[model samples]
Target: MRSRSLFSLLTLVGLAALLLTACGGGGSKKKASSSSSGQAGGTLITVAKGAPSGSPDPQINYTLQEWQILIISHDGLLAFKRTSGTEGTKLVPDLATAIPKPQDGGKTYVFHIRKGIKFSDGKELKPSDVKYTFERLFKIGQSPNAGTWYNVIVGGDACVKTPSTCDLSKGVVADDAAGTVTFHL
Candidate 1:
């Protein structure tokens, strides 16, 4: 009897969810701009994280201010949607074309970056750029301010230790022509 009650409750919940979606829960609803706005591009907002911005190199700065600016200026391999629905909080591909599935018993992740993405310098981004970014992070981010980049990537720690002698490229395989980067754990 308890199992039957549970099943019925679940059925009703599912039906309610379906009804909400059908009623356009996921539909695009245009928002009306406020009449009081002055600028044509809307008001410019300034945010500060209560600290002075430091280090132009992204891998070196760990302060909130640095992160805030970086968040606006940079794109990552993945991103989360800002929506409040089911899509929110889910990891979606950003620079990469899609979320990579782990391979080699969850020890490897291959990312296929979108083609034609350009840097501020107007140069087209390639898979080698991603590899270089990761490598630079591990190499430059040293002791006192070394962020989590070294801890996350597979060969990051070793790369930091030997920076010159070590071949840290083992962790990242970049196929420039194919726009794919494979990270080995």
Candidate 2:
């Protein structure tokens, strides 16, 4: 019992030390915010990173630093709340109307995307874009340790394992008129 208690205390100390190091340089900058500058053109926000941010592609990059930039520059179907609290971890719809309704015994998912969400190119986001986005991930297979999004879709594992032998369009359906994207798992 004594040994177990000592181990727990040591673990707690190590975790606290790591947390302190991570937050040590993240002090707030009062004069840099858009609110103070009165800039109406766009909002300016900043994030502190311990290391350089690499590629910003969601499929090509998986590091915490890359995700920080992606979250700011692009919209996901869902996003985490940006609070300085526990709620920041909770998922919220960014491009979609809400979390999708699961069907077919949790094997199918239908997402209703929001209308008038334009990309940087001024093109309105379409359901087909979602399908293309997902397909690109499998096609690129950026790194061996890529996330398993392809593994969850129907025939997606086969596509990732052997891209030449698979057809991604058969797995996802995008209805532009209905603003819906369906994933067949």
Candidate 3:
């Protein structure tokens, strides 16, 4: 008799849960259908429980939450392959046409920038901008990974110390005509 009663109670609870779930979609069906059926440009909306900890600048923001959104829009000279397992660790060209062979006993690398790339402002992307960005990275002084990750650059040590006057002429060489940015460690 007790076992039968328990089964009856469980059946009632299961029915109640099913009914509530069926009624859960009050009005979201229409909105979801319109957005998914190509009415909108596949827009993604992200909601965070709290505000970001630091500046929204991609170079400045190192938080994982911000990076989840930033990674979708940003590109680098090389990026890890977006695959599962060990294959994901492989380097793939992004803004760069191809990964160049290291020169100077693996202490120097030259990357050929892809042609016809433009910024949001319609300004042409130049190789010199690549050099400028690294300088800015050290000059900002807020990047936590600057010393650990980029300190191998020739002038990175000096740039980390006195950022305002940081010059990486010897460390980074950008050739506008050749469309290359060379880094010397």
**Which has the greatest lDDT?**
3
lDDT of 3 by residue, 18-129 (tens): 1111111113223445444455477777656476577766556666776565545566666557688999766666667876666766667787987876665556777887
Better of 1 and 3 by TM-score: 3
lDDT of 1 by residue, 34-67 (tens): 8895656666768756556666455555556655
**Cα miss at 125, model 3 (Å)?**
0.6
Cα lDDT tens digits for candidate 2, 16-96: 111111111123446765564565697778988876756645566567676566556556666667687898766566666
Question: What TM-scores do the predictions have?
Answer: 0.68, 0.70, 0.72
Evaluated at residue 54, the lDDT of candidate 1 is 67
TM-score, cand. 3: 0.72
Candidate 3 colliding pairs: none
Q: What's the ranking of the predictions by TM-score, best on top?
A: 3, 2, 1
| Candidate models: Cα lDDT each | 0.56, 0.58, 0.63
List ranges where model 2 is wrong by over 4 Å.
Answer: 1-43, 47-53, 143-147, 164-166
